[model samples]
Target: LFGYVLILVLVTFDYKELAPLGYILYGIVILLLIYTGLFVHTIAGTQRWINLGFFHLQPSEPAKLAVVIVLASYYSNHDTEDGYRLRDIIRPAILTAVPFVLIMMQPDLGTALMLGILFVSMTLFVKLRWSTISILGTVAMGGAFIGWKFLLKDYQRRRIETFLNPEGDPMNHGYQIMQSKIAVGSGQVFGKGFLEGTQGHLHFLPERHTDFAFSVWAEEWGFVGSVFFLGCYFFLLLWGINIAMTARDKFGVLLAFGLVMLIFWQAVINLFMIMGFLPVVGIPLPLFSYGGSSLLTTLISIGILMNIRMRRYQIKT
Candidate 1:
């Protein structure tokens, strides 16, 4: 309901109004994230949210949106006919790194990873030169090596280990993925029916109401339901692409596409993580997963997407 309300409210304005305020939003979110990381008490083992009485404001979620807007503003302002070189992306990379490191310090790998993905998606959308791509590819390979060797905590390392061999630690680190896979397989062709899946209702699956929400739904609704739900997500991405292609200006195009990639990667990572194909990184499935912060950010992205589509007829300023 709140998501719907936000959408209704935002589409009333010209999305162009948001362009000028991009850096302002980015700065505010960065400060909020720093406060949350430094002072907020950890809930469920991570200090990713600020306690605001009735609402736990997770600034990292909105940081995703902020990065999209700010990067769009930067890219649109300095768009080149050819592509971005290594030096060309330094500012955006630095803009992204500040939030990425803050979120990483929160040990919230999921959101940090999301910020990195958003940066890559938007930069690629702008078309990087071949020489720049080669440099980035090498740097990414080196970064991955260093991250695994030096930066990953013990539990973070365990996730990757569990992904490869869940049975090795069936009663511990591997438990959630094992149960999630079972829930999905149990659904089969026709599922166990509404409110009937034992894995979820019986507490066999951990985090069923939050990270594993899709598992519960899949278990109850079966293959047909899963396909239908995924199909809807597929269409949403397509619509976002259509909006970007038809948008009147570069900022709108970048904003719409960046927002779509944000949703796209989250959904893919969550589904794969739950199904045991990828390590569990605590990424909530967009819209499907039960999270106020995640839902709000996603809806805002959708609202902005609609705003861009709605104002397609406006003259470019």
Candidate 2:
């Protein structure tokens, strides 16, 4: 498949080659985000994709990876043992904010939220002063208030409200979450057997293959299967983290860690959303979700992790 081919091509070259191009790619994605907002028509009520003929390329999907690379490259170059200070983080903050603002304008809260988490993840990896953490935490709360008030779309607000009280609007905004909970709970201990799930088979679950992909999966596979499914991701993430710890260079370390965090947050958010612990933010369940862009992004990120692992020792010669 194309995913296999992308990983193959990505590992054939040194991932360090990406260091110089991080900002370039980030800039291009930022432009694409702006272009999507200005010219692209809304598909499914979101201007987050481009008509790439064969595929509708979602800029926000790649935008997450872009932030990872940019932050990794920046941190690798400017690292200090004492940890990052207030002044040290300003540029990285701006780099993160640019795409955050642009994508938020498209009003894709999920992707925008991912970007913020990406920045925090990478920044924490390098370590942050308590002063910096407190400052950022306060700012984040303020920003959330602003986002809720003026930035979130009506439907997005409804999703949050529905998260708080699904029964309050069970037929309207609450339908997705309610159905998701049922599908997951009905799976019981072992599941309904593969492709035998009632919720998805009866067509009651919307976005069954996208945002709610895990719900359909859980319905079919049951609790045991769900744990087994998550176990796979657990190993994949741990492998990535091991690679980051073992990588020979600072760039390789940061790159591997940032990419792993990218996968981590997406998977966690999607899982929590489906289980009713978090509002539906439209985050795909990584490789499981039926999305060309999300799948490829996850694949390429894993490839980069492999690339770092493969050449972790070759840097000396």
Candidate 3:
């Protein structure tokens, strides 16, 4: 498969060689985001992809990798033992915010939040002072409140509202969450078995094969199977974190950490969305969701992870 080949190629490739081109790739993705907004095909109400004759490419997918490499490269080169000062985070903040703003303009709140979380997650490992962390944390919470009140578009706000009270708009915005909850609960402890889930099989569940893949999966697999799937994800995260801890250089450490959070956070959010605990923000369930861009992005991140793990040792002179 192409995924296997990508991991093979990146594993053998030197990560350092990609280091210098980090900003270049970042810039290219930024351009792609802008181009996508201005000229790419717009479906429904979002402009988030480019038509390439064969397949539509979502710029935000690659933008995730670009942000990781750019931030890792910057952090590895500029790290301090005592951690960063308030003034020290400006450039990295800009690096993250630029894409954050651009992607948000496409109204891709899910990916934008991922970028914001990526920056915060990486900064936590950068050894900042406790006082600084407290101040930043407070500011971040306040900023989130403000963004929710003012910056989020109409539908975005409605999604959050719907999550809070699915009954409020049962026939419209809340339909997905309401149906999802029913399907998940219907499975109870033992599930209804494969191809036997009434909610999904009978079409009561929306987006059954895509955003609601978890709903269908849970309906068929039951509580035990759902727990097993989550256990696998837990191990996957642990594996990436292990690689980050043992990486030979700062770049390798940050790169692996960023990629892990990228997958980890997206999966967490998507899971929460399906359970009606969070708003449906259109985040795919990584490898499980039926999406080309989401699958490819995950594969690329895995490739980078394997690349870091493979080169975690010094070469013999």
Clashes of each: 0, 1, 0
TM per candidate comes to 0.97, 0.97, 0.95
Off by over 4 Å in 3: none
* Candidate 2, pairs of clashing residues: 191-222
Q: Estimate, for each residue in 1-317, the C-alpha lDDT of model 3 and write its tens digit.
A: 67668877877878877788888989899999999888866687888978888887888988888988888998889878887887788798899999898888888998888899899998887888887888889989998998898779999999988899999999999999999999999888889999999999999998999899999989998999899999999999999999999888888889999999999998999999999889998888988998788898899899988887888887622
Q: What is the per-residue lDDT of model 2 for residues 128-172, given as tens digits with 9 covering 90 to 100?
A: 999999998999899999988999999999899899999899899
2 against 3, candidate with superior lDDT: 2
Compare candidates 1 and 2 on lDDT and give the better one. Answer: 1
Error of 2 at 23 (Å): 1.2
Residue 296 error for model 1, in Å? 0.4
Better of 1 and 3 by TM-score: 1
How much lDDT does candidate 1 score? 0.92
Clash pairs, candidate 3, are none
- Model 1 residue 98 CA deviation in Å: 0.5
User: Among all windows of ten consecutive residues in candidate 2, which has the lowest summed lDDT?
Assistant: 308-317
